[model samples]
Target chain A: MSSFLPDILALFFLFSLIIRRLGVNLAFQPATYQLLTYVLLLTIGLKGGQALTSEFTFSLISNSLIVIALGVVLTLVAMLIIHTFSAMNQSDRVTLAAHYGSVSVGTFAVALSYLQLKGVSYEAALNLYVALLELPSILVGLWWLNRNQSSTSLKTIFGHQSLMLLLIGLVIGGLYGDIAEPMVKQLQPLFAVMLALYLIHMGAVAGSKFGEFGSNQLFLICFAIFMPLLAAAIGLGTALLLGLSIGGTTLLMTLAASASYIAVPAVFEQAQPNANVAQALVASLAVTFSFNVIWGIPLYHHIAGVVA
Target chain B: MTLVFSFLTLLMLLAVTLVAQSTGMVVTNYFMLIAALVVYVGWKSRKSVKVSLLKRGRSAA
Candidate 1:
């Protein structure tokens, strides 16, 4: 996975840029994205479910509780970091905070795939954490959005496809993961291919928006890059506190460094009505997401090597 | 309107069943089948959309 990832990703990213240069129409991209997302998320969830069923323990359950609390705390820290960077409006800060605090499953998937490439075994419960971290930041953001608007609806937060699909994956893994063992063995090679397809689309989407990321002034751009590294530090520290393995520590760091594109926008739109979507998207996708994919993974892996 | 979400629900259930019930090699075999189905449908859908758009442009021109 390690050897092949860089070459294929670079090739795909460069290919996307070439297509953009040639002025080709990519009008079907959003639909393609929906299709890829459906396939990828379901695959991840199903595999995760199977993994979880292999060794379900009380100890793992307790560890998960700690991970959940970590999500809330990280979200607060993300808000604090954003506040420190720029004194944007309260709504904007809270919006950005929630996104930065929440996890990006794609980034997490990249990290896991990277580990798998390296033949490093991470905590399978790591799968559960992506879904677990999805909600708390928004919940925190909602509370931070307004103390008076304190009526938390767990239903609304849980309604997301990302979260629900994962839980379903876990349940499936617990109940019938072993049932599909025969089938899963033959499709193992395609895992990398599926992931590669997803990454190619990632490259195309990010490359198409290449100009938007650069339009920001030097300081804001720097701020966007800096926040994820800081989150990585916090993630690493938290993982150590929990006594997780090197692979698990690296993943936790990636989750910290990653920002949510999927769950956050819908959230802030309703919760903090005055928030700027463009600004948040730029910060999360153009800056943080790019940084993590390009350099953040290696840097986190380095940190794990030293600390873990 | 038969949306993608409806299909997604069924896929997730099937994926869970395959993953949960199977082990190593057999799981991969099943996944290959799933992958073929998704790719074929996605490609076909993409092709049809492009064809329709092209036809619309030609007629308008």
Candidate 2:
């Protein structure tokens, strides 16, 4: 399993970029991208829910709350840094905060894939942490953005497509338990395949956006790379405090290091229409996502190994 | 309509996975199948890839 897959992933990404450079558009449909992402999200939810069948506990609740709080803290800190360094307006700064604060599912998937490849075992239901960590920063961002006015209803936020699909998959897997074992096992083997496809799309997209790198100011680009490193440090500290294993520590570091490309933009598009969503996407997707996939995941693992 | 299709697809995929499992297909086979599928796609897209390689080579020359 480990022999050729990782090498193929990196090769596919570089190949995508090379293909693009040759003026071959590779015109994959929009729906194909959506379907790929949805499959990945559902698979994560299903696996986490299946694990939760036996592992769910009160301690899980405590850990989830801590993780959620970590999201809030990360967002607020992002808001501070962007406020100080970025000359962008208030809404833009808040939007950047939301992006930085929320976790990236693509990054989380890669981290999981990395652990599996290395035969590292983590806490079984860490996907619960992923789902829990998605929301708080978004809510905080909205609240800060619209402090003077009424914010988007929680119903609207919860109804976002990615979160809903994840929650639905989690509920289904949790409810079915061992009855879903065959399906879960089936889905498990397909994860790396699904993720590789997702990353290829991500790489193609990022490759196309490489031109946009220079359009962003120096501070934004610096923030994009450095923020994840700093966030990983914070994540590592929290994981140690929680007495998590090396795998758990690494995953937490990744969740901290990743910035949202999916949920934040969708929500911000609806709520803060005037906000600079494009800037946030360029930073998160083009800069942070690539960094995490290529380098940050392994680095976080090494740091986690050393520290925790 | 999109949401409905997504849900249906999920269900269908789950059923297929179960059926595949019950048929005694092992996990490694599934992995190999996906690996091959990826390779097939790459093969299909080889024209663009070749063009890109030639462009790079010509530029270097």
lDDT of prediction 2 = 0.77
TM agreement with the true structure for every prediction: 0.75, 0.79
Q: Write the per-residue lDDT of candidate 1 for residues A38-74, one digit (tens) a residue.
A: 6566666777778888867788777778777877887
Interface quality of candidate 2 as DockQ: 0.02
**Candidate of highest TM-score:** 2
Point out the worst 10-residue segment of candidate 1 chain A by lDDT.
A213-222
Least well predicted 10-residue stretch by lDDT in candidate 2 chain A: A1-10
lDDT of each: 0.68, 0.77
Deviation in angstroms for A73 in model 2? 0.7
The DockQ figures for the candidates are 0.01, 0.02
